[model samples]
Target: MALCEARLEEKARFLCRGRNPSDATDLLQDTYERAFRAFHTYDRNAPPLPWLASILTRRFLDMCRQDKRHPQQQLTESLDVPSEEAGPAEVWAGYTLEDVWRAVDLLPEEFRDVVRLKDMEGLAYAEISQRLGIPAMTVGTRLFRARKKLKELLLKKAETGGAS
Candidate 1:
């Protein structure tokens, strides 16, 4: 439990990256509670992080489906915010991890998943391929494309004063 608690915030923040922070917090708490209840069933011999991640991914998907039923509950505001009095570096520093995630969300679903798993979640290409059920080579390809796309988008946004 102590170990799980220590990593809970990071796991939740990753799962909720593109979503509202409040909702992300709620989802994280719910995931923790669910993990607690199911702790006994967890295989001690198995790697816990991947197991926890599988659960988190499922829960996030469930929440996404539920959110679809209530469109009004979704955040419609543009995630990109202009830099105020702050300089570019300051504004960049002010950008939340969530903001970076919002940029990630702008990616196509396949690309987004690969980037999240590889870069954010720190999963190896083979692990990501297995988890996402894609070929390892495909994982590399997708990750390359995703990075390129994200770079383009971020650069464009920065130029337009839309991203810090």
Candidate 2:
């Protein structure tokens, strides 16, 4: 574990390839949690970097699969793709990461946790259910509602010019 911690930046940079730089931190976090939970299976003779890297790769793949299962279209996609002239909704064009996260932080705790686990940590609904001790159906339901709420909040933020 100490070895893994010592090489955190190295591992995170490796995880960043083919992904958003922001995802690397969350992927690294999930990998560390998984590694700690499965520490008993680690081979003491082998090096830590390769083992940790393998776990990180699996986590990224899992994240990809999860994303495929729940493909939330990017908020700006419509604005960016359509060749139409800008209108009132043109305000939706520039939602930064900070705006999304700020909106997320304002969500009620239950909704917030669901979003963070499923979206930020790249956890599957089942894993989120287990982590939060909720039924799988509830995880799905909460995630749906949370996403709806996030969209509303973000749109409001965009309309208001990035105000909280």
Candidate 3:
């Protein structure tokens, strides 16, 4: 546990993203418990944060499923919606955040970086350019392309009932 304590804040941040902030502690505890059971499987040579993060992400997804809440009512708040229009929100209501994240993970590395930085981390174009060492115009271009590709991938996933 000592080795993991310092690395948990990032997991907590990930847990709270687009999720109910109140559940962060509970989810973190649950993930820690899971990690404990699986600790023996971990190789000492590898870094722990990525393993812990993987556990936390899967734990959160499992909790969402076990609770029977995804695609029910939580969708109203989980997705990025981007606007007040119920049309887009309702279309997204059937998908869970995990489903969205899975699609994001499928993007090319550079596109994924741009999307995560801009959307998930809430970085402005200028900040993203500075961090990524790319032109601000390139940031906008990547974000636009990433979002358009994301829409296509998500639509495919939606057609397959999120199995894609």
Best by lDDT: 3
Question: Each prediction's TM-score against the native?
Answer: 0.42, 0.48, 0.46
Note the Cα lDDT for every prediction shown.
Answer: 0.69, 0.71, 0.72
The true-versus-predicted C-alpha distance at residue 116 of model 1, in Å, is 0.9
Off by over 4 Å in 3: 1-90
* Model 3's TM-score against the true structure: 0.46
Per-residue lDDT of candidate 2, residues 114-155 (tens digit) = 988866676778898999999999998997788678777766
lDDT of 1 by residue, 59-163 (tens): 888987776554322422212222343234444444455656788899999999997776555576899989999999999899778866865666567668785
**Residues 1-164, candidate 3, lDDT per residue (tens digit)?**
56676567566766666465556787778878998999999988998888888888887778766444333234324344544432355457676667777888999999999988766766768999999999999998998788778777876776666642
**Candidates by lDDT, descending order:** 3, 2, 1
Q: Residue 95 deviation, candidate 1, in Å?
A: 5.2
Q: What are the candidates' C-alpha RMSDs?
A: 10.6, 12.0, 12.6
* Model 2 alpha-carbon drift over 4 Å, by segment: 1-89
Q: Which model is ahead, 2 or 3, in terms of lDDT?
A: 3
Give the TM-score comparing model 1 with the true structure, all chains together: 0.42
**How many steric overlaps are in each model, in order?**
0, 0, 0
* Total backbone clashes of candidate 2, pairs 3 or more residues apart or in separate chains: 0
Q: What's the lDDT of the predicted structure labeled candidate 3?
A: 0.72
